[model samples]
Target: MTTLAEEVLAGSRLALARLLTLIENEDPQGEAALDRLFPHSGRAHWIGVTGSPGAGKSSLVNRLAQAFRRPADGSPPRTVAIVAVDPSSPFTGGALLGDRVRMRDLSGDPGVFIRSMASRGALGGLARTTPAVVQALDSAGFDIILIETVGAGQSEVEIARLAHTVLVVEAPGMGDDIQAIKAGILEIADILVLNKADLPGAENALRTLRAMLELGRPPHEETAESLPVVWRPPLVPTIATQNEGIAELLGHIQAHAAYLRQSGGWQVRDRSRLQTQLEELLQTALLKRWRSSLPEGQYQQILTDLQARRISPYQALHSLLGEPPLPQSIQRGSTALFNA
Candidate 1:
């Protein structure tokens, strides 16, 4: 195991920060450390929050962190980790990293760690390295990891692949009450939050969500009788700016956690997430190997042919890939010379 990973597991915040920076920089050491640390993870409950830009996601996340950070009921203090994903600058590939600005109350709290990540033009509302970083935080002993998506949109629902409980937030006046439905975000939520509940259209938004749920969700009897036991999502209204209904929202989250445990949803979710990671890693590895092994100009000639309309794209691809292609996995950052 890397020294930085050792220190991170030993509760060294500085070492943890350094390891995260190494990951952000795409250092090999960071990947090695993550591979080592992966076994120690899987304990933290990941919560993904997604909404439109003006939906008050940051404020809600700040409030959630504060509520979790303040220990109560004889339980030991709960450590929280927040990964706030922001849009990246196209030219520089850097994020503003300003999500923490609204969370000043949590800055002095030793139990909370907030990281702002740039999307880096990755689709699906997350940085490519988000899962690894989340694993890092989980292994370092955070209790709740909040992943705030790059904002609500058609593609933003990808957070469903990463989090145990997904909160689809909406605020009145941001758009039509049915926008969540239109975007397909409502279907993916484990919990729906109507933020800025004090706004004029709050009731209308709630009604719309309720109507959608009634129309889209399966019957409660069917959910209860299902083999794995399905849990219905609850819509909780909140004024995040004033911290209203945070406790109720937390209660819903806790209930979801309990439900996941009872129904074995945790293992199922972990397996799904792992499969996704494996597929993506395999694809990347294969692409890298293909690029490195391709004869120089062979790819470009295909491109040139297509550009000159001498061949169709599919025909060009077929020519590039001969019959009986190799079936193998990546080994040590290189293509295995033999069957693997």
Candidate 2:
């Protein structure tokens, strides 16, 4: 029997879905399949779409996917994959919104695949398994993967590290222009999209965004040869509900992709993302291995002392690591008196 990874490589959508589920559940089988599939990954362009709540991000993403499937410049259409992340239900940890409902128009397309995921309390907008899911999609031969983040303002900059190009969507009349000035998320945007452009105050919103971009850029130097290639983020106004401005937006996205390739930003982003994933996996593995090696109930005993205030948190951590506790005067922020 062909392995699931082999099936996915042969364009089996059902196998792909099953593998995604296994990966999300942290199944060992999924890890093995992913390892088998990793050699085929990294070919797709990862695009991150993020912004404030109710900014029409879903609509924009929907239109962008269509554009990818039918390029306006008469270029061959590319396969598209979408990973839409929704907020998790606080009680059940289930996705609150089914993004597939909003993207029903693309459901019949053979070249497009959409996956909805729950944030599951993972911070910074994406689900915990999103990058792994993206890798699966990439290995399956998708040309572009759009990752739509949960609309969490400010704390949503994680996508900057994952995607080759990042689109920060903002809507007019939503006070997003003001929030753009205050939010660190704007710094990570490769393109600033003013979605809902047909709404009132659109021009004002556009002007505000342009001004902010100007302020963020470094001043021009007289020596032109000394400067490096810089991509100034363009502001594209779109009425996504009507599919207006989508072609132009796609043009900008394509341009950004070309720039990344020319400037080596593509490889840089890939390296950084893989490094982060490696470090996180290493940390988790080390913690689990260490915890399993400890004497039964010793970890719990440390926690008990920690909660009772009999030992400071630092002391508890040192004890768990089999390290000698530092002197109270030497420990940073050490105020508790240790009784042990």
Tell me the TM-score of each prediction against the true structure. 0.90, 0.93
What would the per-residue lDDT of candidate 2 be over residues 233-324, giving only the tens digit for each residue? 88999999999999999988998998778777789889999998888789989999988999999989988899999998977988988899
Candidate 1, residue 29: the lDDT equals 92
Task: Write out the backbone clash pairs for model 2.
Answer: none
User: Which candidate tops lDDT?
Assistant: 2
The clash count of every prediction, one per candidate, is 1, 0
lDDT values, one for every candidate? 0.86, 0.90
Q: Which stretches of model 1 miss by more than 4 angstroms?
A: 71-74, 222-228, 323-340
Judging by TM-score against the true structure, name the best candidate. 2
| TM-score for candidate 2, residues paired by index | 0.93
Q: What TM value does model 1 have?
A: 0.90
Q: 160 in model 2: Cα distance from truth in Å? A: 1.0
